[model samples]
Target: MASPDTRTQLLDAAERLFAERGYRGTSVRAITDLAGANLAAVAYHFGSKAELLAAVARRVIEPINAAQCAGLDRLLARTPDPPVAELVAAFVGPMYDEMRAGDEGGARTSRLIVTILSDPAEEVRSWTGPAEDAVRDRYLEAFTRALPDLPPQELWFRIRGILAVTAVDRVEVHNRLAGLPPVAGEAAKQWAITFLAAAMSAPPTGT
Candidate 1:
C-alpha cells in the first residue's frame, strides 16, 4: 500500500508533468517513475491515469476557486452590492495571485484547464463539472442578487468564459505586453470586476 506522503509525491509530480504536457502527453508510468514509486502505486492510489489527471487538476484548481469564493464573501458584505465588474475581478484575481506566487505549476495547469475546457472527451469533461459548478454557484448567487436585470444564465456563462480568458491570458499577455506587466492582486481584483460589470451590463454586440 502507498503511504500518505506517497500520494502527495505522486500528485506533485503529476501536476507538474500534466501541466507541462497535456493529459495525453503524460503517462502513469512516467508519473510513478518521477515520483519514485512502484508502477502499482498509481493504480493503487488512483484507479486510472484519468483519475490521476483529475486529481492533479483539482489540486491546482480547487485552491484558486476557494480563494475566489472567499473573496466573494467579502464582496457580498458590501451594502447595496458592488458593481458586477468588481465581482468579475473577485472571480479572476485570486487565480492570477496564485500563478504569480511561485505557483508556476499552477499557471501551467490553468492552461491545461483551458485546453480541457475548450475540448475534451466526455469522461475528462465530466471531471470539471462539479468544481466549476461550485465556483459558478458563488457568482450566480452574487449576480442574481446584484444584477436582477441581467439574464442569469447568460451572465454566468459570459462571466465564466471571461474569467477563463483572464486566467489563461495573464501568462501570454506578459509575453506580448513587454512594458505592461499583468495586474497584481488588488489591481487585478478591481480590473476583472470592472470588466465583468461592463460586459455583463453592456447591451448586445450588434446593438
Candidate 2:
C-alpha cells in the first residue's frame, strides 16, 4: 500500500505536469519521474493515468466547491434571498482566495481545470462531470431564486458567462488584456463579481 505521503507526492507531481503539458500530452513515465516514484506508484495509488488526472482535479475542485457551498449556505440561512452581487461573491470568492494565495500547485491546478473544462474530449469529461455538475447545479438553484424573472434561456446564458469569467480569472488573464490597465489579485475578482452581478441582473431584452 502506498503511504499517505507517497500518494500526496504523486498527486502533486501529476497536477503540476498535467497543468504544464495537458492530460494527453503528459505520460506516466514523466509523472513518476517528477514524483520520484517508481512506475508502479501511479497504479498503486491512483490505478491509472486517467484516474490520476481525476484525482488531481478533485484535490483542488472539491475544496473550492465545499467552500463555495458553505458560503452559500450561510448566506441563505441569514436570508433566504440574497442579492445577486452577494450570490456572485459567494460563488467566486473562494476561487479568488486560492489564486491570491500564490500557491504554485493551486495555480497549476486552476490552469488544468480550465483546460479540462474547455476540452471536448469525452474521457476528461467523464472524470470531471459528477463533481462539476453538482457544484454547478447548486449555484444554478441559487441564481434561479435570485433572478426569478429571468427567462430560462437568458438565465442559462448569463450563468455560462459567469462561469467563463471565473475560469478566465482563475488563469489570471486580466494582465494579458491589451490596452486595458493590468488588474490583478483582489481587484480582478472584484471586477468580475461586479460585472457578472450586473449581467445577471440586467433587464431582459426581448429578442
Candidate 3:
C-alpha cells in the first residue's frame, strides 16, 4: 500500500520523465527512483508502466481539457450561439492561460503537444488519454457551429490548423519569433486564438 504522498511523488517524477524521454524512453525504475519511491508504489498507484505513462500524459492534458471544457460551458451558458471569434477563442483560451501561468511544466507540455500533433502515438492522439470521447465530439459541434457555412472537411482543416498553431511546439517557436518578445504560454494561447479567429472568419473559396 503506497502512501498518498507517494502517489503524488511518483506522478510528479513520471510526468518529468515522460516529458523528457517520451513513453518508450522512460522506465519504471527510473520513475520510482526519481520519486524516491519503490517499484511497488508505481504498480500500486498505476497498474503498469504503460498506464503510468498514460497517467503522466493525463496529468498534463486533463487540466487543459478541463479548462477548455469550462470555457466552452461558459460561452454556451451565455449564449447557445456565440460569435465565431469568441467560440474559437473560448475553445483555446484556457490552454493559453495554462501555458502563460507556466506551472505543471506547461512549456514542456506545449512542446510535447507539437510532437503529438506531428506524430502522436496511438494513445496520446486518442484525445487526451482516453477518458472523454464526448469532449472532442462536443468541441466538434462547437466548431461546426462556428463555421456553419464551410464544408465539413474545410472545418476540420481549420480545426487542425488551430490545433497546430496552439501546439506546445508553437510556443517554442513563439520564443524565436521577433517582435513577439519572449513571452510564455498565454502568449501562445492568445496568438493561436487570433490566428484561429482569422482562419475561421476567412471566406471559403468555392469548394
Candidate 4:
C-alpha cells in the first residue's frame, strides 16, 4: 500500500501537470516523473490517468464547492431573504479567493475545469459533470429562493451567464483594450458580482 504522504505527492504532481498541459496534453509518465513515483504507484493509487484527473479535480473542486454552499447557508441562516448581491457574492467569493490566493494547483484545476466544460466532447462530461452538478444544484436552489419571481428560463440563462463569466475569470486571459485601465482581482470580482446580480434581477424582455 502507498503511504498517505506518497499518495498526496502523486496528487500534487498530477494537479500541477494536468493544469499546465491539460489532460490530453499530459501523460502518465510525465505525472509520475514529476511526482517522483513510478508507473506502478500511479496504477496502485489512482488506477488510471482518467481517474487521476478526476482525483485532481475533486481535491480542489469539492472544497471550493463546500465553501460556497457553506457561505450560502450562513447567509440564509442570518437572514431569511438575502439580497441578490449577497447571494451572488456567496456563490462567487470562494472561487475568487481560490483564483486570487496564488495557489498554482488550484489555478490549474480551475483552468482544467473550464477546458473540460467548454469542450463539446461528451467524454469530458464523465470526469467533470458530477462535481459540477453537486455544487450547481445548491446554487440553483439558492438563486431560485432569492429570486422566486424570476421566470425559470430566464433564471437558467442568468445562472449560465454567471458560470460563463466565472470560467473566463478563472483562466485570467488578458485582452488588451486601447486606453482602458487594468482591473485588479478584487475589482474584477466586484464587477462580475455586480453584473450577475443585475442580470439575475432583470425582468424578462418579452414580458
**Estimated TM-score for each candidate:** 0.76, 0.86, 0.80, 0.82
Give the whole-model CA lDDT for all candidates, comma-separated: 0.70, 0.78, 0.71, 0.74
> Least lDDT summed over 10 consecutive residues: which range in candidate 2?
99-108
Query: Which RMSD values do the candidates have, in order?
Result: 3.7, 2.8, 3.2, 3.2
Q: Of the candidates numbered 3 and 4, which has the greater TM-score value?
A: 4
How are the candidates ranked when ordered by lDDT, highest leading? 2, 4, 3, 1
As for candidate 1, its clashing pairs are: 85-193, 85-194, 85-197, 86-193, 89-192, 89-193
Please give, for residues 1-207, the per-residue lDDT of candidate 3 as tens digits.
456588888877876676666666778889999999887877887787767766666666777788778888888999887788988887777666655444443666666555444544675455454445566678889878766888888878877777766674444445675776455555556677787898888977773
Which candidate's TM-score is highest?
A: 2
The residue pairs in collision within model 3 are 99-185, 100-185, 100-186, 110-168
Kindly provide the TM-score of model 2 when superposed on the true structure, using C-alpha atoms. 0.86
Ranking by TM-score: 2, 4, 3, 1
The parts of candidate 2 lying over 4 Å away from their true place are 1-4, 99-102, 129-132, 170-183
The list of candidate 1 runs beyond 4 A from truth reads: 1-4, 129-131, 152-154, 170-197, 204-207
Backbone clash count for every predicted candidate, in the order shown: 6, 0, 4, 0
Could you tell me which residue pairs clash in candidate 4? none
Give the top-scoring candidate (lDDT).
Answer: 2
Q: Which candidate would rank higher by TM-score, 2 or 4?
A: 2
